[model samples]
Target: MIDFKVLSDYAATFTHSENDLLRQMEEKAAEIYIPIMQPSAMAFLQQLIRWRSARKILELGTAIGYSSIRMALAAGNDTTIVSVERDEAMIEEATQNIEALNLQERIQIVAGDATDDLSEVASAAPYDLILIDAAKVQYEHLFEKCSGLLADQGIIVTDNVFFHGLVCDIDAVQKKQLHRLVKKVDAFNHFLSEREDFDTIFLTVGDGMAVSTKRSCAEGER
Candidate 1:
């Protein structure tokens, strides 16, 4: 396996720098030890948004509004993002961040357990894109819920599928006590990849991202 730290640094050299505000936000997140998406993952998401022209997005985790803001900015001003965060502190911070960015109208932070709050998110159904970055152990459940909420051509992007590389190396000490979580993530990856109704691609970028696009009936038949 490649040293992702080095690869991420090398990729940063080719990507544009974050704006001062975003940079500051990232610095704050790091200071507080909040796990936010890596720069490479953010870049990939921006490009994906542009490519898909996604207008309605649902984010399972709103960690200080980093990915949510990035997606809204990339999808244009009219896009709407419903982000769920179970942590009250994160919800408050994310709401403030979105409001400070003047994106309050574009992003809504829902505070509650994802499993319980997802039903509310589904009310805005047929989301063009769904991003999952919350609890690694609950990924399969989230994916199952997303299937009914996603648009026909919608895409689901799941982060941390690699689980710090433990999913690929179950015996690795990195997953010592969390072996069960690693196993579940690995199984979820297999489930997503083998799903007949979705075309999935697992990328090595940013701790592994599983991008799955639901297959239409016609496309699945062929």
Candidate 2:
């Protein structure tokens, strides 16, 4: 079943010591009013990257570089993460944070609208792991791009499919843009499940995630 919810409050007293660098960045994100990937979500992603021994990773959103850095730390040596962000403000801040961590060589920060021109950015045919967490309305297109760029047994993980529980109750969020985006996300969630080429599992973590892996050639290309 698709579910969303994480244990513990994001801002707790002693949990600040898990990763000092990460904690510092999260605090800074808060100070600057930047949204970040949830801790539970981060942990899940890190575990996946470790298991896959992912060398090449792609991220659609790089807000303050929290997730990208955490993934880098999780994978240790020789891991490359390319994160894309459209906002100049976030890019400037994320650049500073990444440089401060001395991860310039390991991580390549791409500045552009993720939906617009990713095809020209990286010529690599396949990435081992792809993480999606950005504009909700663009996920359908992102999924198409991700599917084209994924390698054998590659996995796709999307965050915020639950959309703060707004997917089920569109009226909860009256903002025109957000409400429409919620509808698109809901449709994508449904589409992922119906695809015979993938086996999707939705785990209960921060904001909900849809984890989809392409069926092997044995599955006969559903």
Candidate 3:
């Protein structure tokens, strides 16, 4: 396998730099030991939002609001994003960041468990895009809950499915403490791949990402 980190860094060199606010937010996340979206994954997400002309977005994680900000910026001024974060501290930080960027109207942060908060998210349903970057173990449950909330033509993008490349390496799993997590992620990957209602592709980008588009009912029936 190629060194994806090296290639991802090289690819980022050609892309434009994030604004000073986002740059500072990224620094803050790093200083706090909070993980944010990788550059390659962030770029992919931005492109997806722009290509889909996403108007309503739902994000499962707001980790310092880095990815949410990127998505909002990419989708333009009219788009609205409802992001969820379980941690109150992260919510506070993310809210501050979003407000500082003058995007309070465009992005709303919900503070609660994804399972519980998703019910609130459903009120804004038929979202053009749903981003899942929350707990690795709850991915399948999150997908199930959010799938019904998606627009017929909408797309779902999940991050960190690879879980640091542990999903694909059985030997590493047996030797490490990530057996349960690796198992769950692997199962989630398989579940997504086999879903009849959606067409899914797993990519080798940042920690691996899975992009799934809901198939038409007729197409799914076949």
**C-alpha RMSD by candidate, in order:** 1.7, 3.2, 1.7
Tell me the number of clashing residue pairs for each predicted model: 0, 0, 0
Task: List ranges where model 3 is wrong by over 4 Å.
Answer: 117-119, 174-176
Q: Kindly provide the TM-score of model 3 when superposed on the true structure, using C-alpha atoms.
A: 0.93
What is candidate 3's lDDT per residue for 195-216, written digit by digit as tens? 9899999887777899999987
* Candidate 1 per-residue C-alpha lDDT over 35-142 given as tens digits, one digit per residue, 9 for 90 to 100: 888778778988999999999999999988889988888999899899999888888888888888899999988877777745668788889999999998899998
RMSD in Å for model 1: 1.7
Instruction: Estimate, for each residue in 27-115, the C-alpha lDDT of model 2 and write its tens digit.
Output: 77668767787667778888888888988888999988888888888888798788999999889988988888898887888889988
lDDT value for model 1: 0.86
Task: Single out the weakest 10-residue window by summed lDDT for candidate 2.
Answer: 8-17
TM-score of every candidate: 0.93, 0.87, 0.93
Question: What TM-score does candidate 1 reach?
Answer: 0.93
lDDT to native, each model: 0.86, 0.80, 0.86
Mark the regions of model 2 whose C-alpha exceeds 4 Å error after superposition.
1-18, 171-175
